[model samples]
Target chain A: MTDRRGTDERLAAWLDGAMNPADAAAFEAEMAGNPALAEQAAAWRANDRQIADALAPLATEPIDPEWLAQMGLAESTAVAPAMPPAANDNPAWWQKRWVPVGGALAAGLALVLLVVGRPPEDPQDGGLSLALDSTPALQQAQLDDGRMIEPVLTARAADGRWCREYRIGDVAGLACREPQGWKVEAEVEAAPATKPDEIQLAGGTDNTGIAAANARLGTADPLGAADEAALIASKWGDR
Target chain B: MADPGPDSQAMREEIIAVLPRLRRFCRGLTGHAENGDDLMQSTVERALGRAELFEAGTRVDAWMFRIARNLHIDAIRSVGRRGTQVDIDEIAETRGEDGRETVENRSDLAAAQRALQALPEEQRSAFLLVVVEGLSYREAAEVLEVPVGTIMSRLARARARIDAVVGRSQGTGND
Candidate 1:
């Protein structure tokens, strides 16, 4: 408790092993005599350990060989083309398209989707599909299951189908209006935001899956608020 | 196919060796698995693209770390977003039914991650590089392009903030 600022710096230096032997020894001796200081030092040490343990799982995730091949560190594996031939032809088409961009997020999203299965064909019975059918972009709505859904962007596909990009909880997805119901074309789990309120979509460039899906569909520019409202009112009717 | 040459081969090997640590560092920086991998990919691409700039005998890890840090900064700037944000409620709901101990451990991990994400970029990077990555303060300073003393002060401040947030969370008895 002598020179609190100096002591804090010394503590951090000692914790990081940045201090020279003599300085570290002196600090250690000070901590030994001062119970409060020792407790503070121990807490900080534990904090570091907690942080390390929290991040350790990320390091242990199996490395994707595509990464090595992308860097030319490994012999080039025959990477799937950026554009898949047909979306419905291969159930795993999204996986191949997203592998080059980075697979961890896509893989996680795929696992969740696999477990949940497709959104219920009957939109009335499905919260996500129901929200997509009606909710306009940039507004948040609560699903029946209690997850928050925010429609991000609205556009039309080349085939005269209406598509909407929306975020439901941590997942961002694209669902196109079809004769049957809103069909989820693609989804990717979004990166967790530091401030949930300030979470911005950044024009959807950060998510390759959504972007690629949009590209393949030849989606026009996202509709403005007024246009989007109109589309919602019309139940995504043909313009 | 042209031989990539000996220097290129050596540089490739060096990068391969550092990939795990670099991936961890990127994950810590980006606060998301996929974003971290994307950044890792971009870092490797940048390093290999600028292979000639790498000094022959210098630490490849440090050099690549600097690249990764700068790229992260640029990304943050481009997106006009500062730090990462985690949904506390989302994390809480995702807890499993394995056991009490498992739930507690996951809760602690989430708290730690949220605390880390709450820090300002400078403080967060310094703490990760020095404490989590086990880099010397000097090496961290080099990677951050700041003086050693700056690293020290940032680390101290970062540690205090983490302690305050985490300590308060634990005291609340709300997981």
Candidate 2:
């Protein structure tokens, strides 16, 4: 250790396999001469292994699902639009896949409405129907009774259920879609000025449902409107 | 207002798949399970909010890693903690190693974690990026926005301290 200048550096470089051949040879010679240095280097290697072994289990730990879902939404948004196909090239195969999926989904939605009862109106109005316009896809969900309902926010629960915060003419309630039908989970007075549905799909503080969903579903984002509609339609028709 | 185009579904699935690695990296840095998770959540939220900034055809792992590191830094600063980002003293106090037993009777791993927690935030970031995450020195340097030499220096110091701590714990530090 005394003979070799930069002994720790030599040992660390050797342990990490960053040493050049000449330096590595010199390091080995120094180690062979000083058994103590050799032992210390071995100890360092063991330490590295220990650190890795201890932390490796962390890889198996579940990431917060809400965060995981949020990541999915974010990454998708990050991707740039596809360049137009080359003059000689045909459209992408995936582009074709969505067409049938879209049509089938819309058809499914209509079919599901036949057996499904209409969503109960706002409790505040004693059953007065809300003047709800069909917004974009992700925020708006169709009920069984030929009525279009918009949830303030929608999310997937950890139990694999789809949950939504719905407002019917100033009355807000939380319901989750089940195999049977929309099961009302909880209900509360509508919070003013907060459209949990339209808060950019990722998140915000105003949406406690988003927070609750984060806890329940791990923050996974709802599918885009078209995708969700198609899925609902398919599931409804299947039932 | 971008419709989830053709690639969106695939991209979403890909991000979902990478969650474990992201969690691991976060845990490695914060050295605290809860804080690390909070950091992971914040990073993903930030990334999703700024998804349009991610360059297509680039390594998403690197991008996310960078995001996590930056968010951690921001979190530290927001708390008005100057100098070291993580509280070394706090880590030492709560160093029960997540209240779990050692990995396969290897107590050295626990010792290594304590040592890791003791390191300065910057050095720990550099060391973990290289050793745990398996990033190259040059690549880690880029992620930390520091010179390669700085990364090398930080890593060397970190390894030496960890070795000393692990050795001392095992009663074989001084041969």
Candidate 3:
């Protein structure tokens, strides 16, 4: 007996016109002899049409106006319109162009000074300096919601982002701090009486909520006492 | 790191031109309009934030699609980490608009959407890119960053699943 499932794939390909002409002709001849294959092929075609019909309506759905504004295309005009001259008529367009250049130069100079003359108290001085300035060693970060969670581990990811694993009660989570704040990347609730290592290996399975979390947590270099202290002082550098 | 160059402007326009299609793709991906729109909004924010990374003169649609796919994966991973997959079948069945009650009997569209949502994420994305987006298998593979054979395999599986669904529904007089 032919594998109906295997034939289903070929029929799907034939329906998609993805099959080569020679193979298509052979399949057609075979289907002419096999009523079941033909019926299956017909069903698959009907299904494809129905899928197309059903999904075509989605193309007409209205987009949110806010999204348009966010893309800077609310005006629906050419992307870069010519900038009008500044209200002061003293500067010609050519001279007006120099203003942005001067501003950029001043900005670049300021950046250079800031980098070269960083204050000794600057939080980002060095890893050691940051450690020195950090709050006394504590493994907790107070979330904006005023809930406290223990930071189980802190490490610099390969991407150079500092990430942390935190535990709130029995649930553990991973988050990497961005310039804005702590962005929770993943979380898993531990199974009762499960060891941390076991949960780490088991991952984020629905029953245990452990396996997927483990996979996402992956391997990270653990921050030492001083680095963790620095991170805590930096508040994940959100400051 | 948004670039204010003319190329950036042009890319923004290109993205806007594709917004309807992008929204449709999101809706198809997420199984609910609200969730899809939220995902679309997030996609727009990330695209804008990383505009400088966009290569000039490249297909912005493909780039945006890649970004959207990555974000969707991240979101689902986050949800998985939370200990449950989104029950897309239920979400697709009960999803409604504008305070209207969800249809008592699921419509053909809902059924099709549920079927699409039922596929694994990899398969769903493959089907959408090839069938809905009208991309060639190679192009879809490029967008997905997978081998062409992988794209074909994924599309085959996706089609088989949808075909089985529609075929069953038809056999039962539901379609």
Candidate 4:
């Protein structure tokens, strides 16, 4: 949608931050002249600030561990803005079908809660830091939100597709940046990243994507070093 | 979900760092310090329990938020505390790092609390998740278990209501 159309639908998405970079930019540009839209954005900001500030008090309370531990089954209740059930309607169907077909899968699924409580890493530092380059190099990063990203060797298999592994979400995944776009070859079954480094950013919004793409290139140390920040700044770090 | 690693050590380190933000989000939902900690603890426990459920191709915060939302709803329901609410001023008074002595007029803080508490739960959740907690609409919807469109509408409506409340509060004996 061309953001200039001035529809409430697009505006709502923009306010909620569902807009892609291009759309968001266009929407912001229009906000310069659109009084109604500007007012709407202000009110939204105000509302958010007030609520956040107000809710600040009750955030530190501790739940009775004994109570939480004794909790067996969750209470069945309904609330507003309801959506589809996350679980299948027929639990028996799964019991009869996929359960029998994949024994190991069934075992793995059953052990999920107990086996996977621990995180892949502790997220107490800064964030998921990364270095992307036009050349291949070993890069490590902590994300702004505290998720970590690190990379290593890449090689082409018999089929001639370059394959490498990186952490996505909370698990490690084998991915190939093919002509079609990056695709996960295999997924790592592991705990979630408390501070996730993953984002499905539109074309150019990510500070890391440029570096990731650069690393995709066959170069010496594709992710420039700390001084390289100045170098990247000289080229594309205008922001 | 796909973070680059064998960085279990690294990931654990970062999780420790981000706990404060998670605590903040938890605080927003529970409305008091004690409940917020309980909420955070539940959030952490759930995150650990559902670790494998964390997709390798999604945002980490969004995922934690999903766990947090479920836990919050679960706590509210399990305790059978439907629609039994409390005063926002009391929350601030109880939870404020700096007590009432720090405030110019305590009513401003009180007014802010009342305005937020007044919003419908859906709108309140949407506004906090999007504006304060910084989740995108799709992420917030995922947390709230609703469509992105629903999130947007609730947020918009929440904003309108807050503006009205704040405007009214500004005019009254309070500021």
What is the per-residue lDDT of model 1 for residues A1-239, given as tens digits with 9 covering 90 to 100?
54877788999999888899999998899989999999999999999998898776554444565556656776422222333233221212223332322223333322122111145367543356667877778887655323467888898999888888877655667788877777787765544323334232221122256766777789998799998898789877745
Q: What part of the reference interface contacts, as a 0 to 1 fraction, does candidate 1 reproduce?
A: 0.55
Tens-place lDDT per residue, model 4, B8-68, is: 3344433444455677666555544456566767776776555566666676677776677
Best by DockQ, which number?
A: 1
lDDT of 3 by residue, A1-239 (tens): 24764666577567666788998999999999999888877765676677667776676444555556655666543222123222321211111113232132211211000011112333321122222223233444332112235555666665666765555443445555455344555544332222223222211112122223334445366779887776666666654
What is candidate 3's TM-score against the reference? 0.53
**Model 3: how far residue A89 lies from native, Å:** 33
Ranking by lDDT: 1, 3, 2, 4
What tens digits encode model 3's per-residue C-alpha lDDT throughout B49-152?
Answer: 88888887667778888888888888877666765455542334234221222231338667767677767788888888777777777778888999976776
For model 1, the stretches where C-alpha displacement exceeds 4 angstroms are A76-239, B1-3, B81-109
Alpha-carbon shift of residue A145 in model 1 (angstroms) = 44
Q: List the global CA lDDT of all models.
A: 0.69, 0.56, 0.58, 0.49
User: Please, what are the lDDT tens digits per residue for candidate 2 over residues A124-154?
Assistant: 2211122122233325433222123555555
Q: TM-score for every candidate vs. truth? A: 0.54, 0.50, 0.53, 0.45
Cα misplacement distance, residue B16 of candidate 3 (Å): 0.8
Model 1, span B63-170: residue lDDT tens = 988999899877766444433442321122133121122122355555655676667778888988888878899899998999999999999899888898778877
Better model by DockQ, 2 or 3?
2
Weakest ten-residue segment in model 3 chain B by summed lDDT = B96-105
Query: Fraction of native Cα contacts kept in each candidate?
Result: 0.55, 0.48, 0.43, 0.34
Where in model 2 is the C-alpha error above 4 Å?
Answer: A1-5, A64-67, A70-239, B6-11, B81-110, B172-175
